[model samples]
Target: MGRAPQKVRNRDTNPCIDEGDASLKCLDEHNYDKSCCSAHFQRYKNCRKYWHSVMLQRRGDGVRPDMPTAAERQELLDAIGGKPY
Candidate 1:
């Protein structure tokens, strides 16, 4: 018998992610002046970090909860056959 599909947040449309994207867009519109949009930049960083944690947790592998660094993110992207953005 076929099992029903489980529901999960759609990454592209998640509200938290959308907010992060909006914050990024604003920052870009302002010429990427971090001093001018530090709060928005911080929010985007936090949102992306949380999403990364959630994804690692869902992998069912023993992933640590330590704060991820840029190198770690690059490593993960490489392991997953993706290019670092």
Candidate 2:
């Protein structure tokens, strides 16, 4: 058997991982039918959008690492005064 969707690791260290995992799970459950997972797709897209904006803002501020690592993300969340997701 293949690995469970929840067990899929985020080696990329990008943001919105939970949304990505949910989309994967939806696709798995629906036999890879994209139409059946539209909501999950939309959510993942929105998450990418939100994080991209944050990345751009940080870049403008001259912060290194346009995309934050996992540990940096928690500091970012604290700095931003709450979690976006």
Candidate 3:
């Protein structure tokens, strides 16, 4: 039997793609040296942490779709007027 096709996700569906990509790009530019990509990695980590908190808050408040849709995420960010982290 053939394996099932893998589903691809992008920044829209996965909010942290840009931060993740920046970290990866840093790694590539630095020839896979971890030290040079520390800031990128930290940024990615912060992004994930911020989103996770939002998800948890939504879940606690009994919001539908615990992970907000892209538009909803954007609205929340706009309302806050800055980065969650």
Per-candidate TM equals 0.42, 0.68, 0.82
Model 2 over residues 1-85: C-alpha lDDT tens digits? 9975653356344778788899999999999999999998988898888889978998999988777877887787799897664
The per-prediction CA RMSD against the true structure, in angstroms, equals: 11.6, 7.2, 3.0
Instruction: Count clashing residue pairs per candidate.
Output: 0, 0, 0
- Alpha-carbon lDDT, every model: 0.59, 0.81, 0.83
RMSD of 1: 11.6
lDDT of 3 by residue, 49-81 (tens): 989888899899999788888888889889999
Better of 2 and 3 by TM-score: 3
Q: Clashing residue pairs in candidate 2, if any?
A: none
The residue ranges of model 1 lying beyond 4 angstroms of the native Cα positions read 1-17, 28-32, 61-85
Clashes of 3: 0
TM-score of 2: 0.68
Cα shift from native, residue 29, model 2 (Å): 0.5
Question: Residue 5 in candidate 2 has what lDDT?
Answer: 64
**Per-residue lDDT of 58 in model 2:** 84
